[model samples]
Target: MASEVVALVNPNTEAALPFATTLQLVVGQATEKGRKSQNEDAIGIRIPSGLALITKGVVSVISDGVSTAEGGAHASAISVSNFLADYYSTPESWGVQTSSSKVLTALNRWLYGLGQDYRDARRGFVCTFSALVFKSCSVHMLHVGDSRIYRFRHGELLQLTHDHSTNINSSNQYLTRALGMDVNLDVDYKTLSVEVDDVYLMTTDGVHDVLTEFEIHQKLTVLCQQHSTLSDDLCEQFCLMLNKKAFDLGSKDNLSSQLLSVSQLPKQAIDDVYQSLSSQPFPPPLSVGMKLDGYQVTHTLHQSQRSQVYRVVNDQGEAFCMKTPSVNYIDDAAYIERFMLESWIGQRINSTHVVKVVELQKIKSALYYVTEFLSGISLGEWLTQHKKAPVEEVLLLLKQIELGIRAFHRRETLHQDLKPDNIFITREGVVKIIDFGSCYIKGVAEISSPLTRDRILGTADYTAPEVILGYQADGRADLFSLAVIAFEMLAGQLPFKGKLEKCRTRQDYQRLDYISVHQLNPMVPEWMDNALKKALNIDPNLRQADTCELIHQLTTAKANQTVKDFVPLIARNPVRFWQVISIALFLCLVASLLNN
Candidate 1:
């Protein structure tokens, strides 16, 4: 059952830089069934492309099924296959630890359930599992049983994972933990930074138990010294030689070894990235009655420093909005790339509450994208029209906007720049989110790029404090932004009232005052105001966990109390508070004058 399957290719775009800092891995593996009835070892690897590479990362797994198991080979195959498939399917919003752990836990429980059906554990599905995930600039390892992951770098060999076994004897050891050994499973996890030209090795106990660490170190050192970079074929030969040496040392177990050498890492240079992004000539700004690629420009819709939007109609008389990149960024490819990304995101996200990208059937002459023309007013305009809108109506629009935000979150994306100007209120009372130029996709963010957008892209007043402080933004950041919109919709004003701009530090953010929603708009109930406060907390940690939680609280009714009960008199009515103090002082002065 031994098979030769090697060469896990990194599918990200090839670096144009001569000295790129991107990760490029060359992989090779060899497996053997040395004197065994069937090979019970499995190996698998995945190198994702583009955004997936950043979000899900590259993975390599090795498993060794217990010989005592009835279907040992099947167990090994299932363990490796299921893990790789499920790991990629996990939510991108989650960190590697959370995503990988959840997948492994579910897989472990399933394996255990299958084993519990058997009278003897040995007859059930059982396997040792070890996996390595290469993500960002770090390597994450997960292991159970006796399978191992190793790193060989700079003429030194380092064991990355500990074996989950106890020595019954020198010749016979017992697995203390495995995938199907019990209902509860404990998987060892570790993370380490990665450097270019580093070699990673994954092996079964069949090879590691027989070869001493010193011998393994010597062989790897010699290979490294002989060649700066080993070819795929040479790596495969080295792995097979290790297996053969172990077999010659009186080991009869099935053996497997996988080797991965990082050849390149993403370069910090921006020139190449800019060249790639600005390859296309910037489209000329279209004016009214102009024609381009059979689309007649009817009128200019919107204009900004980044791009220009025009209402256009094709020969078929179908109306659409053509968005073209601004000439200001004709040489700035990173900005152009982001401008194009907005259209890409618009096309993928399918929701009535989100703008839809019009499919371009014919080749375009310039760098422009077309989307369905929306016959609706912007949320900003709607807010201006209804300064004191009813709470029920505002909630309806907010709920729809929340749905649109959810669509982004479900795909592990965040609309980093969510404001009233980016929201649309249709003539039919539908709310839709527009402008994905500032969106952040977790997977896309991981892939190394020359263009750095480390600063916050959102409006400070509506953006989460964490984002403004140059911290990584998650779905909670979007929640905070949405809460700001909701607060504005209900109260016709911001909660903090420009206080965020003054918040240069975390302490400043914490000290900022929260004005009660009811004080501005008595129409909003106390519960709704409290809910908005929780969602709009300056600290992301103090905010609601998710949109669902916030929406639930917003809809939940609580006992109505006086606004003064929750808000200070000075904050609620500053003028009235000062007037009361003045009157009291004047009364005391008049009484003193009468006594004199």
Candidate 2:
């Protein structure tokens, strides 16, 4: 058997832009040529967005279809690639309504069924599929088998996808899973916001198996410099170089490579450069009696059950809001450790949609952190006081919330607790995300305990179905909560409102009906309603697994709506209007007197 690899990309179609579709693919023969063949694949596409109704993108795959007793390998490979090409040509909305998981599952089952009915059971044909979808500044990946995806950023090549191999006990070399191998299958999918100048490479075992990570990085550095004109040419040259190197080293396997080089520099690097030239030095620490870190503290913020928040100076110096433990977290030691972990995680995250942490300090017993002083009210409080916000405002706020959360997802972190109190709306109409004390990093092992089991960590009203049942938490759980929040934000009521503690039972949680946003606000787009329903699904597997996808959907919906959909509801709530006006008048009077 031999290894088969294919690489394809949509070339830069527009003359004004630097963006181009680049796919580098390779296929090689294995030692036991008759027993097995290499099966590697890839796909790419441009999804619809407000920025571009028709996105320009590419999809490419290299698969060594299993050699069947009847020899259907070539046919199978052609079928898979052609199907993907046709699929990518259609609008993204026309595909599976859910996430990529469902799409891939369906594709796998369909291929597996076809192979089984061919009457060539002895001849097995399976291939590892790895794909990259790039559009604008984002990249989505779908992969399986031993093929790998690597990103070269900051002058280094970092492997992005994990290999599923049967040789885990030894060389970790056998393919444990592949499309068309079985009736049931699972696929790993992820989305990343790309920065210009970041290089992405997807390759079969031929290149990765022979070269060390360091050696690969070195080659990438040299190739990046030499083949700067044509990304595809660079990848081809690199593959040829690796093959020669492997043969020289007495390697005995097929060699293949797929490389993608992004020409634009990453936004982070640009931002860093700007900051280096423009940023001022950090201001000196405040004296004990001095104020203006934003919040007015009547007393020090104190720790509670699993969290603590403090009251501190506000900009006006007459009011206050809460800050939380900078150190000595009152939560269990593990929980307390999360505070520091969150700080570290926060550094990687940057989004105006999320609550902003102002500063962090480590004092003996007074270790405390500062953040924007939210003066208006929490989403929960607003809902209680004014019912639901105007449909437009609710949707706008939800968009902001999703924007912040999507930023976190870009950094591979999840806000495990996303309830009403955690969502704050400032008096100035800014939506602020709060309480990341329970956030978790994706792909990282979480601390476990009896208390952590099936026990809910967020407010009962907004907890997802899985969390209520004591199931493990993940990005889906956060999506579920976001759905609930969206429901409450529009409907002026919790999706499931009862005794909060009693709702912890799985059955009780499952019984709640998520009020459709459209039902509450007719102006809400149907697409949004559908997306929210999918997010709030009781079956975690059925829900939107990626926050970035959800954000995209919500943003599209918001953009599709009319101006009336965003009109502020404050005018309809006399109480809120009066309060805001009264505060403003008071400030105005104080300023006038000072001037006189």
Candidate 3:
């Protein structure tokens, strides 16, 4: 048996998070042939360092080769190796499930192709695979076939994976699903909340089938009593002991086991999600040259009813933009949470076209966040300065903005409040997205909170029709907003003749109309205008799949509309799209009430 340990330490964990405690873990793994002539079981653990350690977290994988297959051993080894390598190579912005699933899908395809050399794939390369990913405060597990995953918490051992093999009898059994066994792989994915002192166990059937859960619990309990920690030596000894027991019990398969001990986990309560900043008192209204936490307010850039922005400079003379929630919302839980979410989300996103959220250097004495300041003018301001920009320049600006939006989308986020006023263009012509106050994060939204966390609407003019119609929105909603911006930039007017903002009901949406860019700007090509029209489709279903596709159409002349379909009231009487939906909903409500 062999053993290794990986210890993770995040230097900026607290700076990036509101909580002081970060994810800390101790990992140990072991494998042995036990009564078998060769060990077809493979177990490996990868605990990356640096930023990846924080974003991708630690991955532990195990695979059991089917002895009946000619290349079973090779398949198991390759699966384990490929998963670790490919998973880490995926974009850091992707969530754990997306990154792992895509890697596994590709890995399975490669292995399945190799198995085609045999008349029966079962007689070629085949293996049962299981992987445990420890990310932030959650554990994501992916499984195929009979390998098992378990968790030992608070002195109890609980099975976390199900066996995929069917039990016709003790002497006869067959795997229902496994990697490289079929073209279409159906893998099970499971996610669980993690806490301190949690020890997760992964094992092959050689040890688990021979030992009941209770027996495993007893053995785990003894290990806990004997050692204060799941150090490399202790974890290796535990695996070796399990292998010996299974061998003595007449087990005939290879043995492998892996252990993960969660030593520290961030605070779980939503209120504590950013407790440090959220608990800080809102700073008093600032005047020019006023200093707070060593940052001097050189100028108040902008102030709205909801928040305030100021250009600030510190001792090092570094220029930055600081944003503060209005004192009016100091007692508003929802608003405060939303305000906090902006800073939290900003700290994680990394894109040149996106304003960078600066990590807090000194202890903050007030409720505010800082971002790198760039000398730039808002897109709205720029639009007013130039009535109609060159077609090439407009496309260039749109392309940069798309990059920023794509960065957010890659992280499963949506800039719900996309608009001209919320975007900035540096003197160098670099477009940077700001104002994440209305942004939506898929992972963060799943967190439990007692406060009524609602979708705060963005600017009505740029907000998608679906959002106004009270429908669930995704990236398409943002695309709709981007399309509106693109249209406004080209024609120097709103698509529906500035009537979209007045829309309230189905009738108003139905009355909506589009003003072609060529009629106003004349310089916009027919293809570019068509692309913008498609993107501004009132129905999200009809809009471009993503911002990149929309940008592609504008830059590529051949990307022309190839099909025709009836758009609802919005396309014809554009203002009527919003009204049609509201009126229909109102009539439905009346009918239901009368029927009741």
For model 3, how does the per-residue alpha-carbon lDDT over 1-596 read when each residue is reduced to its tens digit? 11111212123322223322256688777788988899999999998765566567789999999999988899999999989999988755467888887888888888899999888756878999999988767889999999999999889778888899998897878899999888788999988998888998899998888888889999989889888867766777777888788888888889888888887764455444435335568888898989998999999999989899999999999999999889998767678767766877787789999999887755677678899998979999999987778888888899999999998998888889999999999999899998899887765553334456777889899998888888878899989888889888888887888888889886677567777888898888888888888888777788788899999888987637444445556556544777888899999999999999
Off by over 4 Å in 2: 1-303, 313-331, 359-366, 443-456, 496-501, 504-506, 509-531, 544-596
Model 1 accuracy (lDDT, Cα): 0.79
Model 2 poorest ten-residue lDDT run: 6-15
Candidate that beats the other on TM-score, 1 or 3, i.e. the better one = 1
Global lDDT of each model? 0.79, 0.55, 0.82
TM-score order of candidates, best first? 1, 3, 2
Q: State the lDDT at 120 in candidate 3.
A: 74
Using lDDT, rank the candidates from best to worst.
Answer: 3, 1, 2
- The residue-by-residue lDDT of candidate 2 on 154-212, one tens digit each, is 78777888987766465444567777777787777777767656777766665577778
Question: lDDT by residue for model 1 over 66-153, one digit each (tens)?
Answer: 9887766777888889889999888654557667888888887788777777887678888999999888677888999998888997
TM-score of each: 0.81, 0.43, 0.70
Which model scores highest in lDDT?
Answer: 3
Residue 347 shift from truth in candidate 1, angstroms: 2.5
